[model samples]
Target: MLLKTFRWAFAVTALGLVAGVLYDGWTALGLVAILAVLEVSLSFDNAVINAGILKKLNAFWQRIFLTVGILIAVFGMRLLFPIVIVAVSARLSPSRAVHLALTDKDRYQELVTDAHPSIAAFGGMFLLMIFLDFVFEDRDVKWLSWLERPLARLGRVDMLSVCLALIILLVSSMTFAAHAHQHGGGHADKAQTVLVSGIAGLITYLVVSGLSDFFESRLADEESTKSDGAGRPAVALAGRAAFFTFLYLEVLDASFSFDGVIGAFAITNDIVLMALGLGIGAMYVRSLTVYLVRQGTLDDYVYLEHGAHYAIGALALILLVSIRYQINDIVTGLIGVTLISASFYSSVRRNRAARE
Candidate 1:
């Protein structure tokens, strides 16, 4: 299973290293290796969360995820998405954005960095809502019963996750605004940018999640209503579910990739190298997600999802705080790794006790 999952990752990593060396010698190779590691480290929790979602998908959708989905992750998000961001933000044509990225590396990076506040707000709020929803929703099993129970009770309130996210965004924006004012900077603009981006994120999450839920529920109803003699219709129902599931996974991947893309700049300004390294890492993450889902890791290691969500919550806060402060990406990644590792260990211990 490990070999099946990681075979492509190894091949891609080799290709990335070769490309790295050809591009700018051994130094570039080393940088690519470091960036790949960084991407993988930062995205482990993302893979865990993805597994929880991907397991619900059918075999066809899972295959699509491995094939078409990886293409989207590699070229679409890791490569083209950055260029698109630069184009839209700087109001440049796509060709112009590409030229700027290749010819004037620093300017390209500056444009990307300048747009970080909005990106952070959007990605951070989206992730925050994910974490909130996971924590607040009632479940048969609880990892942190004391905390989750209270949150679950609160979840009964309509749009609780949306409301809490807005409140947090408001607080974060106000805090940043005050700090900017004290420093004689663009206070109101900063606040407005954060608010608007966060609202956009919230609306996006609501809409995408709503659509997915609606289709999923409809599929469930159809499946339940089908007589035993009917078996399962392979095309219509499954295709619709697969389509929406694909969209959900793609959006989820985009949200997860935002921080990795931005953090890659801290390592290298070369867009090609960044894409190669991060793309390699993203492929590994997708593979890991598939492994977890196929192996029932989420079911076996019961608290794993809880840990992943908690890590996500931490990451969301870090992203938001990073709008005003420069936090180390390694530190953020390490926090998530630690939380999930601890949970895995706890799960092992619990299983051992259960067997005894």
Candidate 2:
């Protein structure tokens, strides 16, 4: 199973090595390898969460996710999305962003870095909500019973997650804005940017979740009608369900890519190289997602998803802190890997105890 799952990753690594050598000699190959490792390490939790969603999809949609979804992940998110960020943030044309990336790499990096506060706020808030919602839900299976039980009880309060998120945002923006102003910068402007960006993130989550629920409900009704009436009428309904599912997956992947894209700048400021390197890593992550679903890894290790959510919560907090301080990327990546690995170990111990 391991050999079969990593076949594509091996092929992509070979292709990436060749491309790196041709583009900028052997040095580029090393950078590509490093970036690939960084991406995979940071995104393992993302793969676990993706499996939870992908399992609900039909086989056809699953295949589409591996094939079509990969294209979007590689070219759309890894490549085009960064360019769009530079374009909009710097108030330049897309062509200008591309030219600046290839020619003025240092300046391009500065602009991207300048935009980080808003990007961090947006992605951080979105991910925090995902973690909070998962932890608060009442469930049959409990991973960290002491902590999760208390959270589940608190979940009964209406809009608890939203309220908590807003309070955090308020405190963070005000404190950071004040700090920035003490050095003679524009305090009010900084605070406004954070507030707007955070709210945009919150609204995005609400809209996407609402739309997905509506589409899923419609699909369920169609399935019931088809089962009762006996006909091929439900085929169109299946397509609609697939469409909404596709949208949800794309949005989720985009949120995951945000941190990776920004963090890549810390490694290499060259946009093309970042894309090539990170693209290879993304293909492997997608392959891992499919492998997990096929192997039923999530079913075998029930605490795995819980661990991923905890890692996400940790990451979200780090990003939020990064708005005012520089957090080491290595430290951020290690926290995620450690949490997930510990959970996997606990799961193994539990399975053994059950057998005994």
Residues 71-119 of candidate 2: C-alpha lDDT, one tens digit per residue = 8998998888878888997789999999998999998888887777778
Clashing pairs in 2: none
* Sliding window of 10 residues with minimal summed lDDT for model 1: 176-185
**How many angstroms is residue 116 displaced in model 2 relative to the true structure, after the best TM-score fit?**
0.4
Tens digits of per-residue lDDT, candidate 1, 1-356, equal 89988888889999999998998899988888888888899999999998988888888888888889999999998999989988987889999999999999999998888777778899899999999999889988887788889989998998888888999999988885335322223778778888999898888888888888888878877776664656553333366666876787888888888889999999999999998899889989999999998899999999998899999999999988888787899899999999999889888888999999
* Top-TM-score structure, candidate number: 1
Let me know the TM-score candidate 2 reaches against the reference structure.
0.92
- Against the reference, the lDDT scores of all candidates come to 0.87, 0.83
